[model samples]
Every structure is written in C-alpha cells, then in structure tokens.
Target: MPARERNHPLRLLTGALASSRPWTFLRSSQIGHRIRHSLSAKLAVAITLAALVLLLVFGIIVASQLRSSMFETRKDAILADASLRFSSAQSVFSSSTATSPDQVQESARGALASLKASAAGAGATNVALLRSEGSTASLRINQIEDEQMRGLITPQMREAVAQGGAQWQSVGIRASDSDKVSPGILVGTQVQLPRAGTHELYILYSLAADQRQVDVVLRVLVLSALPIIVTLPIGVFALLHRLLLPVRLTVSAATKAAEGDLDVRVEVHGADEMAALGRAFNAMTSSLQDTISRYDELAKLQQRFVSDVSHELRTPLTTIRMAEDIVWDNREDLPAHARRSAELLHDQTERMEQMLADLLEISRYDAASALLDAEERDLRPIVTRVVEACAELAQRQGVPVEVVAPARAAAEIDERRIERVIRNLVVNAIEHADGTRVTITVATSATDVACRVRDRGVGMTQEVADHVFDRFYRADTARARTTGGTGLGLAIATEDVAIHGGRLQAYGEPGKGASFLMTLPKHAGDEIASWPLALWEDE
Candidate 1:
C-alpha cells in the first residue's frame, strides 16, 4: 500500500497523539462536565497536573545546572592542559639551533608535531603555530596542522593572547575529514622562536565526551519523567476512589431517601468526618420520617372526622329539607314578611346541604378512594346540559354563555363527574364574569380533548390565577357569598380532571379576562400529548 493511503493502526494512533493536546482534552465539554460533577475526577486531574508542572520545573533546573557545571569544569581542564603544552613548546623553540628561514621552518614543524602527539592523549583535536603580525625576523615560520582549526580561534582570542597571558574561547570544532562539528575550546598564547620573531600557538580541544555525558543525563531525566507523568493520573484516580467511597455511599442513600425511601441509611465504618456526616444524615431522615408519619395520622383523622360529620348531618338535613319544602309550598298563603323569611331559610338550607355533599366528596379524594367509571360518550350533551343547568345564574348575572362544541365531541370519562366538573366551571364563570359573555369552547384532537371556559369579566391577577383552584381560596374575601358558592368548585373540578389523567390550567390578566382550560385524553389510559385548544384566546 502507498504510505499516505496505508491507514495503518500505528500511523493513525501516532497522528492522533501528535495532534492531541492536554489543555484541549481538559477543555472539552464532555470531559469538563464530568470533572465538574465528579469529585474523584476533579482531584485526580488537579493532583496529576500539579505533579507534572513540578516535575518539569525541577527537571529543567537540574539539567541547566548540570550542563553549565560540566562545561565550566571542562573549560578549566582545557586551559590547564594548553598552558603546560605552551610551556614545553616555548622551551623547545628557545633552545633551537636554527639560523635560516628553512631551518626555522623545520624546527617549528618538529615542535608542532611533538605538541600534537603529546596533546592527542588529553583530548586535543588540533594544534597550530602562526607568526605574529608585524613580526620582523630573518626567518618567520607560520604553520597550521589543520586548515579547519584556523577559523576556530576568533580574532578576539588572538588579540587577548597578544597581551601576554593565556587566553581561551569556546567554539565549534569542524572535523578535518567531514562536515561534522563538535563543541570545543580554543586556547592561545604568544611564543618566541630562535630565528623567528613573535609567534602565536593555539590548541583546540573537543568536548564530545562531556557533551555525551550531559546528553545521557538528559535522556535519563526524560525517560524517568515519562513514567511519572503517565502514572500520576491513574494513581490519583484510584486513591480518590478509595477516599471518596463514603461520599458515594452517602449520595446513594440520599438519592434513595429523596425517592421516598425513608428507611434507607448510609453504612458507617471508620470514625472519620465521613462517618460523622452519615450519622447526621441518618438522624435527619429519621426525624423527617417521624414527622411525616405524624402528619399522615393527623390527615387521616381529619378525613375520617369530615366523612363522619357529613354522613351524620345527612339525616338532620333530609328532615330539615322536608320541612323546608312544605313551608316553601305554603309561603304564598302567609304574610309577605313570613314568605320572604321562608324563601331565605330555604335558600340557606339548600346551600348548607350542597356544602355538606361537597365535603363528603372531598373526604373521598383525601382518603384516595376516588374512582373513575369511564365510558366512551359524546361530551357535547354534557356541555349543553351544564349550560342549561347554569342558565338561570348566567341570566341573573346578565352574562350570556355561548357553547361552541363540535356535534360529535367524544371522550372516555365518567359522565357524572365530568358533568359535575362542567357545571362547576360554568357556574364559576358566570359568577366572576362581571356581566360579560362566557364562552365554552370545546375542541378535540386525535389523542386528547379540551374545553376552555373563557370569560371577559373582572380578570384576576397572576397571584390569584395561581391559587384559583385551591379549596376555600376566595379572591374577593370581603365579597358577600351571594352566589351561594362553597368555594370548592374549582378545586373539585381540578381533582376530577386529575383523576382521569388530565390537566386543568387557569390563565388570567387583570382587567382583561380569565380562562380555565381542561384537557383530557380522548381514549382511556392514553397520555395527553397536546392540547386541542389554546389556553389564551386570541384577541
């Protein structure tokens, strides 16, 4: 396969590794989210990153100090060796027996050869003898052993050598045979010959050994650091997992407790802070469980008392209703004041009986005994009947009610409860409508049906709208109970709809109007996906 199109596993892996960055991975949303949510991941990443930074800084400092110290020590050794060689070479030229240029050249060549041979054992790479500039002698000798070594000694080194003491410079030593260059030091000094005048002697020493040593130390540091950097996250993650085990258990216990498992408790082992937290959590749940138990008992007692009272009052109410009917029938034969009093008494007695019936129904709901006797039935008849039943109130309040429903609006619902719910909605609308027309819009979809009772009346504010369905919550507290409302109509309607797996919502804007929308599944046991009618009517 062609290399570019090979798709080799190792190539793919290397490409990914080369392109990936630690910060990029850390900043990724998935990883960031996990780290933010998970205590273990957060601690692991933090500790590992800190270790990596400390290791890198420590390694850089050690390598820099080690390389600098090695170079300085090698420079000193080069200077000392070159000085000893310079002394020996100078002595050889001073005792030379040369008279002509040819003889001086020969002596210079011999001294250079000897110096090269002696310094070769001390890591010297090249040596040179050059006549000083402006030298006036009968014979002047300028000899360089290697051409490449000439340029290695800078002009600055030459000038420093001319001032009378030994001078050295760090440089690169190019090989005589190849282009390879190694780190080196050049030491130069002035020398005098028998026939030749002043001359400069230079020695170049290769630092390849010292360079190799430093390279070795660097490789060791990098290799050791690689394992440490790779293992830090894994080790920290494992340690965090072990350390956070108690927290995990506590979280699990808390979740179960939130899900109504009041008996759930964290398992405590060691006498640590985590153990203390577990103890505190267990105590809180126990107290909450006890408090809920007491509340449940009180609620049960209240329901039973209400249920018993409602049952007990039915007998007396039935007796009073019989006597009230007889008096009402005979009111036309009595005085005008007596007849008015009889009418008022009859109205009050009827209101009390209705309130008692509502209380019994509420008791059933509170005790969780409410049942739905659902049947597939057309809802238009129910809506029409509710409108007809509340026709008197709507007429009395001067609020005209309009029912806009399809001829065949059908749903699975208990006829009695649904009728009661519709009745309550109609009555409530007429009462609060402020003499404006009340509209009952019934719409249906494939899965759900809805009814909206919209009234252009004295609209409630948002706060009133929110709690309009709460039992005994009157928006106008000082208003007389002229409508004979028990104040549980909306609340009972809400419960009725909820029992059928439906929803009832209220929408209102002060001074505009109020709307109550009831949505239900068309088929029994089906979920309501969407409403057929909008909650707010379009202006």
Candidate 2:
C-alpha cells in the first residue's frame, strides 16, 4: 500500500483522539475560563460541541442497528435453505425401493451429488456428507478433494448426531492443502433404513460467497455513511457560523465601545437575533454618545458663566476692600454704632469675595479647564506656613494650633495651589475648633508625602462627612454661621489636590472631631505610589 493509504486509518483515529482530549480537559479548565472571559466564544463553542456530539451518537446508534439487522437476516436465510434441503432429502430416501447397502449408499451419494452440483453452480463451495454409524464419508464433487473432505466430522456434528435431531451450526473448514481456513454452515440429520441400521446424514455449505456479499454490503454502508457523517457536521458548523457571525461582530463592537471607542458599530443584516442585538447595541451607543456630547456642551457653558461672574465681581471686590481700609483707618472718629457697623461691613465684604473666588475655582475644576504649573517642593514648609497664617485667628478664637513634622517631605505639585489648599483647610479647622486645639501633622514615605489637619471639635456625622467635600454642602446650618464659610472651601481644596494627581480624604466621627489628610506623589509626573498617613494612629 502507498504511505497515504497505510496512514489513513491512523490519521482518522488520531484526529478523533485529538478532538476528545480538549473536551476532557475543557470542562474543568478551558470551558470555564472561556465562559468567565468571553461569553460569545463560550456560547459558540458550546453549541458546536453539542451539535457534533448529538450527531455522532445518533449516527453510531443507527449504523450499529443497521449492521446487526443485516447480519441477522443473512444468517436466518442460510439456516432456512439448509433446513429445506434436509427435509427434501429425507423424504426421497424414505420412499426408496429395497436394495443392497452399497447401492443404497451410492443412490444416496448420487442424489446428494446432484444437489451439490446445482448449489455449486449457484456459487456455493465445500459441499460434503458424513455417515453416522461409521467413519464413511463422501464428497459431493471431486472439486472438494481429500484434504477438504476429511475434517467434516467435527465436535458440533458429533453432538448433533448424538442428540438425534436436525441441527444447524457454523464451523471452520480447511478448503485446500494451504494454511487458509474457510468458514461454512453444517446441517445434520438422523436417518434409519431397513437392514442398513441407522446413519447420520450431513451437508456442509461454505460461506465464502455469502461472506463476499456481506463484505460488499459493509463497503456500501461505509461509503454512504462516511460522507454523510463527515459532511453533516461541516454543513451544520458552516450554517451556525454564518448565522452567528453578526452576533460575534456585534459583541466585538460592544467590547470596543466599552473600551471607549464610541464609533464602533456592526453592519445590519437580515432580521435575526444577531441583527436585533446589533440594533440594540447601536441604539445604546448612540444615546451614550449624545448624552456625553450634551454634558460637554453644558460644561463649556458653565465654565463661561463662572469666568464672567469672577471677572465681574473682582473689580467691585477690589473697590470694596480699598473703601473698607480707608474707613477702618478712621473708625475711632465715628460713633460707637457706626464703628461697629463699618467693621461688620468690612468683614462681610471680605468673606463674600473669598466665597466668589472659591466658587470660580470649583467651577473651573469641574469644567476640567484649569491648568497647573507643577514642580517638586517640600510639603513641610507649606504646612508650617498655613499654621503660622492661622495662628493669630486660632488664638483669638481660643483654639491652640500645633504642628508636627517628622522629616522634610517633598511632593510634586503646584506650589500656589498646595499653599491655598493648606490655608483653606487650616482656616476651616480653626473656625470649627469650638475652643479645642487643632494639630497639623506632615509625614513622608518613599513614594508619597502627606499632611493631616485634625481638630478636636464637635465632629460631623457619617452622612455629613460623606458630602463634606461637595460644593456649598454644610454639616450643620447653625454651625455654618459661626464658621463664616462660603461652603466651597473643601470642594476647591479637593480639586486643587486632584489637579496635582493627589488624593484628599476626610475621617471623622460624631463628638470625636475630624481629620483631613492630603496625600500626593513624591516625584514630579509620577503617580502616588504610597500612603504615608495611617487610618488609625495614636495622637
């Protein structure tokens, strides 16, 4: 055989083995991993495997049943023919005339020979006969020869004779002097004759021709089934893949959209589940894009509004501050009530100007239109300066201010912004300290620098703490009066810290005061890699 033909069966078996190995391990590993990571791939693989398994099982069961039925029918026909021949031979011999034993044997031989000749012409082989009483046997034709005829009296034949009944059996016979053995059917019957006593009549029929017919049938079955079995899966897989192709595309587009590619879309095809999915995904993306566009437009409009308001108020604020300074210089010449009112007006005007400035800063941050000129600087000095600026106010409010610095810590930030953030935090702390001392602690680590402003005043509740950084949000309406805050202080400070790629967090509990910690990156243009401040620390 050629190499290709020789390896054909091995190749088929190997392919089957290879296909099964993945299935064995897939259920526990690959399938689970695919399901967790890729839903569409998982579904496609699952459907294809299920269809193939069903086809394979159904094909095997059908082929096995067909083969079994064909083999059974062939065996039954062979037995039926042997039974008819035995019955006919028995009738013919029972009605024969009186004769010598030799003549009787010769007539019987002749009759069997005629039947053998007819069967041989019809493509049968190894026809023979065996006597029951003695070792006498006869071949139906000389074509059978001596070696092929001698082995007719087998154990199965002897048992059939001993049992004294018509019997049928399949046996192997040596057809020639060669080593090859052929399979045959044997029929045995008991015969009784006058003065001849009893003898066994046997007929041997070779199954070579029948086996050749069976082989042809098997070849046909395989030829027809092989194409169907192989092509059916291919056809089904192709149809399924085509049907699901749109769904796969839609899924891919959705993934891209999730990854911030809003322009991705699937081409709409026939009305199917896949097409419906594509349409739905397209609709969702369109809505999301529209919403985002509108948000951008509104943000621009808000930035313009904040800019206009800040510019318009700055001129009036400058004039008011200058006018207040002039009045304050001559406050002793006025009456008691006028002096008090003038001081109040000056304080209120300054507070209003600060409020407007914080609002503009917060609005700019929200619009993402603010730029920072960042540089590496020490955080320890900034904390100390903020503390010094708040010191006089702290004393007037009867609140002691303390500073703690473990080491000189550096961070990459906009110096002006960082200083403003610290100043706002310190002033807010002093205003809310309620006669209790406030502590400013600066700390450092290899990757980050941190400053924490902690106060021992009446603290905020959880609900209030959650929204403490929200613009214009107040923990207590009554408390805001004493604090004299514009409510944009924390919000502005948070935005400034964020612009420097830093984080600001607040920790507080009712009646236990509050702590505000700012953490920033230690290296310029690098992300914050460590948090220096612990959540829980001893005072």
Candidate 1 backbone clash number:
0
Cα lDDT, model 1, residue 62: 78
Model 1 residue pairs with clashes: none
- Candidate number with greatest TM-score: 1
Superposed Cα deviation of residue 264, candidate 2 (Å): 6.7
| lDDT score, candidate 1 | 0.82
Candidate 2 lDDT, 1-539, residue by residue in tens? 00011111111111122233222432778657756675445555567677667756764565455445643564466556656666676676677674775667666776577667655543345455544545333422121124455565567556656566666565665645686555565656666543454556666667565555545654554456557655655566576667777877887888999898988877888787777888898999999999989998987787788778887998988998899999988999999999998889888987888778777777777667789888888888888888787778888899999889978988777999999989988887788788898888889999889988888888777788789998778877865455477778888888888877788888777777888898888765568888888643545
Which pairs clash (backbone N, Cα, C closer than 3 Å) in model 2? Answer: 132-200
lDDT of 1 by residue, 1-539 (tens): 00011111111111222333444343778878988999999999899889877976786677667766776677667777888899999999899988888888888888888998899877887788877777887665556656677676667667777777787766776666898556777778889988678999988788777766766676777767778888889999999989899999999999999999999988888899989999999999999999999999998898899999999999999999999999999999989999999999898998999899899888889989988899998889999888988888888889999989865768999989888988887888888888898999998888898899999888889999889999989999886554787788888898999988899999988777899899999876677988899989756
TM-score each candidate. 0.81, 0.64
What TM-score, to 2 decimals, does candidate 2 have? Answer: 0.64
- Alpha-carbon local distance difference test for all models: 0.82, 0.70
